[model samples]
Target: MTVVVNHHGVSAADVLTVARESATVSLSVDAIAAMTKSRSIVDSIERDGRPVYGISTGFGALANTFISPERRAELQHALIRSHAAGIGAPMPREVVRAMILLRIRSLALAHSGVRHIIVQALVDLLNHDITPWVPEHGSLGASGDLAPLAHCALVLMGEGWVLGKDGHRINGGDALMAAGLTPIELSSKEGLALINGTDGMLGMLILANDDLAHLCTMADVTAALSIEAMLGTDRPFHPSIHAIRPHPGQGLSAANIFRLLQNSAIMDSHRDDFEHAVQDAYSMRCAPQVAGAARDTLDFARGVAARELVSVADNPVVLPDGRVESTGNFHGAPLGFAADFLAIAACEIGSISERRVDRLLDVTRSRSLPPFLTPDAGVNSGLMIAQYTAAGIVAENRRLASPASVDTIPTSGMQEDHVSMGWAAAVKLRRVLDNLTSLLAVELLAAVRGLQLRAPLQPSPAGRIATEFVSLFAGRPGPDVFLAPILEHARATISGRDLRQALEAEVGPLA
Candidate 1:
């Protein structure tokens, strides 16, 4: 499927389909026309000898200087070459694709005053799968992710490195030539128009936002399985309790849990049984509160990202009346704060998941289950080491959750002072995602094991489906058998398949 880029309106789902599902991309002809008209205005202004920042004049820190018309092309080339100072590991191919799409979207807004040829060059690269090698580091997130985006601009001029369709690194010039493409000579403000934006930060947020949304749904499913495995009371998920406060996420989560556990023979068998009291521990009882808070965090981040995706993060925008005006749409504080919030939300999911895993392993807390859910206590370690591993990740997630937005260091001679370390924040969120995936896998494994012990007493339809899905990958644990396969199976079960979709197909849509 061809994913269309509409500058004014792009959805998170579009990003996921293109980035993950290998969807083709195309830009609208109307968008190109709009950009060309804007560039014509900029050209008319320059022909009449009007001073425009970075177009007729110079860039930041050099804004006081003026360039002669004869050196305009040289100035544009020099800006791209000078800013192509990005270092460190190459960013993922998906992120590079996202950056390309976002940059094109921003230019499509007709505010950046870039030539049509430059926009076409970007679209050609996307269509031909020529992904530029952008470095992960070097963006302070202020003044529009200048350093990293410079690498993208360099590729348009055929001056950087790019991965070809065959996945081999080659000079951008050679790649463009091999694909029957010609290098674009940036004109006037074209170079600045390409690189001067928050596309880098916005691209990262788009990917992270999509991942976090899926993770939120998975968290609710895992929590439901854990609650049933513990035979916990369903009173915590009662509608009356959540109706008083009515936080959308909390109420939605409660409704989901209640639906998942409905018509369970195990719950019916234990409805009148006096195991302890009316409630389970906070980890089991307050699952909605912990997971719902993460849901709310995702909602907030989505709002910020939606606004940023449609914004023009360029400088020296061209007006309809043939005038140039410098502005500050390139600041990344909004994206920075949103990425930090996503990091915190993911960390909480890991934190609460680890605790639930701990409860499943504790002999006293787990009731009839053996210590660490092992068939034999002293002979085999069972899931004892798995809990330790989950705990270690939980601790690391807490450390990764530290807000990268709060800290900043002066760069570009302090002219670009007060940066938003949004790159760091986005990278940390990716780490949290990896850790949470593994942590939840461990919980699912333990929950399945505990559910096996309670067999003959049937689980809810949702829990039954989860049990069968997990059992397909993991088998019943036996004494003196190596558990490496079980752990691997559990990891594959959670990470390799879309658990939420599978459950939704069986139980209908979740709240």
Candidate 2:
């Protein structure tokens, strides 16, 4: 289905579909009208020789320097060329696509004083599968992701390179010509409008938010599997237990665990074991608290993402009454905060999962399960190293979760003294999200192996389905084989045929 961007603005979900699912994109009639009206205002400002901060005057510290009309277009050209200073690894294909889609959506708000053709060019780039080679570095998150967006803007100007449909590198001009598209001729303030916004970090935020939301849900699913494998109890997840501190995410996570473990012979087998401890370890018992809090953190992040989706993050906003104003809306502090918070939340989720993996590998702690779930514990070493892999990622996540927002160095000769290190925050959040995926996969494999060792006694109705689903690619209980293939299967389960989704089909959606 086609997604529309109008004067009223777009939503985060729409961006995801267009960016990730390859949905078709189009500009709204209202958006075209808004852009036309806003563009006319800029023309009038230039005609009247109004010293608009970004229109007729220089940018940043040189805001007082005015440019003549004849030189205005060159100003834009020079602005994009100079600001496209990003140098590092190219951004992920999905992220670049998202950046383009988001920049278009924000422009669709009709406050950036850009022509409709410019927005349409971005749409055509996406429709034609033309992705610019945007770099991974160079954005302060203030002045609206200037460096990252500039690289994107460079493609629109036909001055840079792009990755084609075949994933081959091609010059931006050549790509545009091949797709029957043409480069943009920047107007007064057009370059600034194109490059000034939180699209870079916002794009990453959207992707991370979507991934982390699913990860948080899957985190619960794996935790349930681990709990059962460890002979842990689900009583702590009862609604009555969570009633006093009722966080929506917590309740949802608890309810999910409670339902997933229903009718489990493994849990029931130890239900009346007087010799067994009444409570389980914190890693097993506090699953809901950690996973639910991650869910809640994402809830807040989504709110911010939604706001950014509909916002006009241009440096100087254009109003309907033909007024141009400089504003700080382009700062990415909100997104930076969301990204950092998600990193911390994802880190904690992985941290707990690693603990569960360690317990499963230890013979004494794993109940009756074989050591490392391997037939020959000492000779094979089993999943002993898997825990170490997970632990390594967990420690890296701690560093990724260091809150990039807390520290900022002055840039632009301190003209932008207090910058929001939001771009860094968003970038690291993606890494944290990736690391969490692998970490969760490692835990899933361990838990599935533990459940397999408990064979004769079946898992819960829900657990049985989850285990069976993973077992297809996981193979049966035995000595270690190619662990990468096993982990790949686990990652695919959570990413594609999600264990939670399978349970939801039978028992309904979890929290």
Using TM-score as the measure, the top candidate is: 2
Off by over 4 Å in 1: 6-9, 164-168, 480-489, 496-498
**Cand. 2 Cα-lDDT:** 0.87
TM-score of each: 0.95, 0.97
Mark the regions of model 2 whose C-alpha exceeds 4 Å error after superposition: 165-168
Q: Could you tell me the C-alpha RMSD of candidate 1 in Å?
A: 2.0
What TM-score should be assigned to candidate 2?
0.97
Instruction: Indicate the TM-score of model 1.
Output: 0.95
lDDT tens digits, residues 1-511, model 1?
Answer: 8877754645667766766776777777787778888988888877887777888788877886889999998999999999988887788888888888778778878888887678778878878778888877888887877888888888888889986656666798988888888889888888888888888778888888777766666777788888888887787899999999788888878888878878877778778777743868888878888778888988898898888877777898877776678777787888888888888888988898889989988888876678888888898877899899899999999998989999999876667778888777877788888788888888888888888778788888888888888877676766745666877777666665466677788787875
- lDDT, candidates in the order shown: 0.81, 0.87
Error of 1 at 36 (Å): 1.6
Residue 155, model 2: Cα distance from true site in angstroms: 1.3
In candidate 1 the C-alpha lDDT for residue 472 amounts to 78
**Pairs that collide, model 2:** none
